[model samples]
Target: MAFVEPGVAAVEARQADRAKIRAVAAGRRAVVIGAGLGGLAVALRLASAGWRVTVCERYGSIGGKMNQIEEGGFRFDTGPSLITMPWVFEELFEAVGERLEDHIQMVRVAPLCRYLFDDGSRLEMTVRLPDWLASIRNFEGRDAAGFLRFLSMGAAALELSRATFFERSPWERPSMADLAALRRPLPLRTVLPYATVVERSCRDPRVRQVLNRYTTYVGSDPRRTPAMLSVIPAIEMLHGGWHIRGGLYRLVRVLGALCERHEVGIRTGAHVERILTDGNRACGVGLRGGENLPADVVVMNGDAARLPRLLGQTTASAEREADRSLSGLALLFALRGKLDGWPHHQVLFSGDYSREFDDLFERRRFPSDPTVYVNVPTRTDPSMAPEGCEIVFVMANAPANDGDLWDVSMLGEARDRMLARLDRAGLMSALSGADLVAELTPRWLADSFDMPGGAIYGANSHGPRRAFLRHPNKARRVGGLYCVGGSVHPGGGTPTVLMSARITADLIGKYERI
Candidate 1:
């Protein structure tokens, strides 16, 4: 295999040498845009492979959404509080001959999360399988066996998919074929339907709602999500969920340090205004300050939908017009005192979950009553908050952007409504008279991370086609351009994004070796 420049025009023999020179030059310089987890991982992987790698981040900090903030003696990790599949981090460290445990201390939580119902009933879902089963039995009698059966199916699906689908580059379509042929796998058709698992295993509406919420972790609705998602709980319960000693943000810091150790050049506050192109082939990137940083390969870790603007023109396969995933409306409250009744992580579902999903994904408006996720890291890590206080991240799914005009008055009213709802649901009583130290909304996330319309996950997983039709790892038309992130292959969440990075790295490594 030889290096090929993307988008080079055909020329006569007289100009062939010039084209070859440009192609070789393009193949030697690799630039990674966005210093998020995916970008950092790729930079580290490429650098370890002896490729000159440079990572550019628009924000002053390296972590994109995973960045943290300190306000009035309270510290909060602005995004992604949960950490799953600790091996992913371990792999990145091992790639550079280091151990993650040396960089960051992680503690596994027994009850990964707690769900509180409107009627004051609560269920603590633990990482211990026996404990979780007991909780299920307590909530809905005789449903424990059914839940176990559902988990078994999910485990099988996860095993099949993780080995075959999650580890390969999306650019290598035939890679999947080769793996399938080698393994002689069962078709996805053999797996149980997602809807059947929920309906059969859960008898109570609340129990069903609690189980269904897991789908949202991957940006899918449980009703529409494939039964393959059942593996999520199995992985969580069996393998366990972890909480980093300081905060989840510490993981980003550790990754950044690992990249530095590998001699990967990292540039913060340096934005790529445009991708420098030699005809259709990406040769390098032009920074915001009008400086040109040449690259042989370019990997985008930002939102895939926004790639066209950065590239300065749309490629043949750039689907910029596609509808995006639902964004979130968040309220990060730095309370002056601890939340009395709440656990480390809690989900308070609305009375009508189906209606809420429909409104956010279909009606394109903020749900009248939204299912809320409340995360208080201080419960596990006292360092996050001052003595006698806590940091709470309250989030609910909202329209990415409905083109509805937003006003300060409307936002204030919405906050009031959300606070009232929390009080009414008995999820939080501190909000009634507590002093707020910090608050963030969708607008903040958009402005800070450059996420279009503040959409968290790039696209929704609604239809079966959409689930399989996610953005590929490599540009179908542009050579030397690749994508690796939440918006790309293997889908969203901490573990999946790390998987995407690994797949992209392996592809780039193979190409370099050839």
Candidate 2:
């Protein structure tokens, strides 16, 4: 009554509530280093679990590689054009009391990806299995049995992945029961190498090339990357590849907004110079500006290849130390014409698939005949382009920046070759007078994304253990130091990175420090 003497009671009540909130925060503080998708996801997740979370990103803007390069009235998503698993993003939003659909409008890609072989053969992988199968049969003249077998292989791996590899602790090895669930051709073939799977399942070289390209999703070298990666194609076929109505940058914006709604503090341009530690236990982080922010738990959403240095250690375990994954050479073109007849995603296979892999993984040189991945986002989201114009994100799997090979001269040469290859493949005829908006080589990726050598997917799943034995979400040796993102298990891709974020959050719950 009497206006409570100009809101004196309300002020006191607010002070009391603030005291209680501070008391609760005293025991829980989390510092997420990076505002990438993984960092943003985990930051919101930790905040949802009552942790006072702070996300520090070196870049002025968030999203990391999942960003946009806007120029010449055209907008392009820099990475990950396809959304194979919408459920992952839905879960992310659901956990934060938001609906993914409310923030993002995604339309199912009718044909997930269109594949073009060296022989000018074309196959459109459609959302409907019957349609895809018909196209395959029409083009390759292959029986459904071979296709069924390949799908089965992918399904088996997917089943096992969801049950064992994805859900389990990265620090733990699979049990016999886990192996039983896999129920594959054999143990030797399942996890050992890709050669066995290729020899058995991939019969037609064109189909094989298409299937082999799936490994490149995680930046794995299909020639040496384990057969477990066969799950990728199945994921696309089963889960369905959806494209955001705007761009992936829309998701980034929504994620950042959700973090804000949850009261998670995100500071951009906060470069973590060092991860302060106390005998393998993370103490806090030292910002580049000589600022120290102490935290009870530290989640690193950075590329884990830099983990050892972040911890100020010389080396990582032989088992945990993974080889960096393949990098990419991206060509973002601003063209003055609408693109028709091209799916949202297109893969033009190389003439010599093995030689291409050899050039990328073995010789560490640009492939003479590179498998070109053309992404026309404007096809689905027309707003991405101007009137009568299209924005194209063309990519080629390239070697990681090895020995500074991607110099200006070298990149120019690679670009010329890429244009020639595109022309030869009949893809360049679509672009008679196209403007090159931007070219992001591995060198640019490494410099921009903190990805060592611009290894986009983080670690190459080479050898037997490489696929399954990636750097764990929970650092085996360090306390209060956890990792999530493309660099760590359970591997890269938008969905897998989200999975890693989920796993790291769970691991943090079970972490002894908290």
TM-score per model over all chains: 0.88, 0.90
lDDT by residue (1-514, candidate 1, tens digit) is 0111112221132134223333333335689999988898878766665667889998899888878887777778888888877776776666656777788888776568888777778888876788888888887777788777777766776666655566575346554444664475543532445665678776877777877787777666666666767777767766777788889888888888878887788999898898878877778889986899988889999998878888876553543322676667678787777676567888887878788778766677777777788888888888888898888888877666735444687577667656766877765566655556556666676788887777777876656556655788877777778898998887888878887887777666555333
Cα lDDT tens digits for candidate 2, 1-514: 0000113442353234334433454449889999999999988877876788999999889999999988867998998898866766776675556777678888877778888877877887878988877776764565456766767777887776765676555576655755665574533456656655765664577777777788888887777877767788888887788888878888898889889988899999999988998887888999997999998889999888787777776665532223678888999999998777777888878799899988887777889888888889888888888888888888888877646657789898888877777787798988878898889998898889888788888778887677777878887777888898987888889988897887777667655332
Could you say which candidate leads in TM-score?
2
- Model 1: per-residue Cα lDDT at residue 136: 85
Model 2: how far residue 42 lies from native, Å: 0.3
> What lDDT score goes with residue 417 in model 1?
58
